[model samples]
Target: MTDYSKELEIAKQAAQKGSEIIRNYTSNQNFNIELKGKNDLVTDADLETEKVILTHIRNVFPEDQIMAEESAGERRVPEARTWLVDPIDGTTNFAHGFPIYCVSVAMWEHGEPKVGVVLEVGRDQLFTAQKGRGARLNGSLIHISRITDPADSLIGTGFPYRDLHMVEHYLDLFEYLMHNTHGVRRPGSAAYDLCCVAAGYFDGFYEYSLNAWDVAAASLIIQEAGGEISDWEGDDNWLFGKRILAGNKVIHDFLLNAVEEHFTPEERKAEK
Candidate 1:
């Protein structure tokens, strides 16, 4: 197997660089924030941090493509060696002075995530993973939670902010989870939410209207940590498909079954 330690190192540095920018802006409270859409936010910190990350990657691997959330906007992930960067994964939380934001960086080779890193800026926690290597949190190996029953599971999720038309369907699922699960939390950052899954904090996570950059890095981390990730259809289309349900082995299957029963094909298509 090809070793991705070098790529993983680069990813960590890139994430740290982006995290520094996020911290600087957050501390100074000087970033210009704007709404990308309803309840969707972007900030100058996001743009500047993305530029810094893209430049850092180019300096080490100039031939690789880059898909940054701010710059790539509605573009498709290229079918090549590419760096996916989400400079600030929780802009709304960050802008509101909440400490749950993070910087996520991942390297993908031909649609496969090779290396992933997420820096939880507030607590200075680092989550890293390579394709074949096990996942880590601050250099210690981590694994997914073994909780199987929804009645005992603590789930994580993101609300459908961009499309209110899908709210009723989402709420239907949410209501079921609320009644069945131990509790549900929306942490405002999908990257961190997935990292929480990899670290075993959240037993599972499901959401719609997520983008490539939001889940790219964390998806690999989840897999390396011995979890599973897929779209609502329980397929590999989660990266670009906008709907994702992720968890450990048993919970993944449980969540997939729940997703299938609650969501319709028409709703999934409309998200795309």
Candidate 2:
């Protein structure tokens, strides 16, 4: 097996640098926000942070490909050593000074994630993981919660901001989880929500319409932390599949079954 210690360090460094940029721009209310779609926002902070992260990565691994949120947009997952970056995952939260955003960075080689890092900017909690090494939060080893029952679990999720085609079915699933689980939260950032699952802060998480940069880093962290992640069909296509469900083994299965009961095959196929 190949060692990914150095790549893990690089991901942490890039995420930290990007977090600094996000913090610097947090106090300024006029960071030049624009809309890419009806409810999708892009800000100067997101663009500037992405540039800083990309530059730091390019300086160290100049030949590596990058798919950053503000610059490269979305692309097919390539076989080369590619870095997936989301400079600020929760642009809406940051733009409104809600302070629940993050800087996410991950490297993929041979079509799998090799290293991952996600830094929650508001609290400065850094999560890092390598292919084989266990996941970490601020340098301490972390693992998923052993909560087995959905009724006793706290679930995390995101609302559909850009795409509303599946809103009705999504809300049905949401209401079902609300009545079944201990509680449900929509934290705005999918990356941060997934990391919360990795750190055991959240027992599970699910959402739709998320892009590759949103989950690439956090999904690896979840797996390394002894958790499970997959699309609604329980497949390994969560990265680009537009839907994700994650949790510890038991809670994961519970969520999967809930999804199965709530969503239809036609709705699942619509996302693909």
Candidate 3:
């Protein structure tokens, strides 16, 4: 069995340290921004925060492998423990001085997330989860919203970079959800979106074309907060598949069914 308490402490410390780096850089009057891809962006803050988080993780868990957004070296390390890190979950928002970004850290043991942390830097809100231990925001326990009716629930989602071919399909899904739900929010940060769901700020969240580092940490938070998580197909292996739907139990099944109903044959083939 994994030492989840120790792992959670390490993840919390790493996220807090990374958040400090982000807070310091965000306050600076001038910072450099760069494009990682078409619409995907990076800033000096992202790299600096990654460096700090990796340094801290290595100092305490030197033998563990690392998969990070800014500096991922290899896919597999022939080890039992792997750390997934996203220094800044909402780079575009952070670059534009928006306060919705966060630092996410998760540890995977035997291919499952065992502990996770998502730190909302500007707000100083630290969300954490350990398997079987429950989830917390700041220092208090959190739970998903109890809203059962989709029409009465506020939902959150993300739009992937335009060039990805699924953009149109995603838009269709977004439009459908917008008309069906009370309100829909695109926060540009998957980690923040899931954290919001865990904290009951958003009743549900779904998105396509996300990376493992993007959802690994926040998924644990949602599940531990008495919410449900799954792939677009309503499967549990969301980490590897790059698609996710999360919400409280009452709405999770309903939302998944709605999403499945809209998947065209072509879209299904593309997913495959």
Best by TM-score: 2
> Could you give the candidate ranking by TM-score, starting with the highest?
2, 1, 3
TM per candidate: 0.96, 0.97, 0.93
Off by over 4 Å in 3: 73-79, 265-272
Q: lDDT scores for all predictions?
A: 0.89, 0.91, 0.85
- TM-score of predicted structure 3: 0.93
Clashing residue pairs for model 1: none
Over 136-212, each residue of candidate 1 has an lDDT whose tens digit, in order, gives: 99999999998877799999999877868778778888889899899899989999999999999999999988889
Ten residues in a row with the worst lDDT in model 2? 263-272
Model 2 spans > 4 angstroms off = 270-272
Q: Model 1 — TM-score against the truth?
A: 0.96
The better-scoring model by lDDT among 1 and 3 is 1
Query: Taking the tens digit of each residue's C-alpha lDDT, what string does model 2 give over 166-221?
Result: 88888998899889989999889999999999999999998888999999999999
lDDT of 3: 0.85
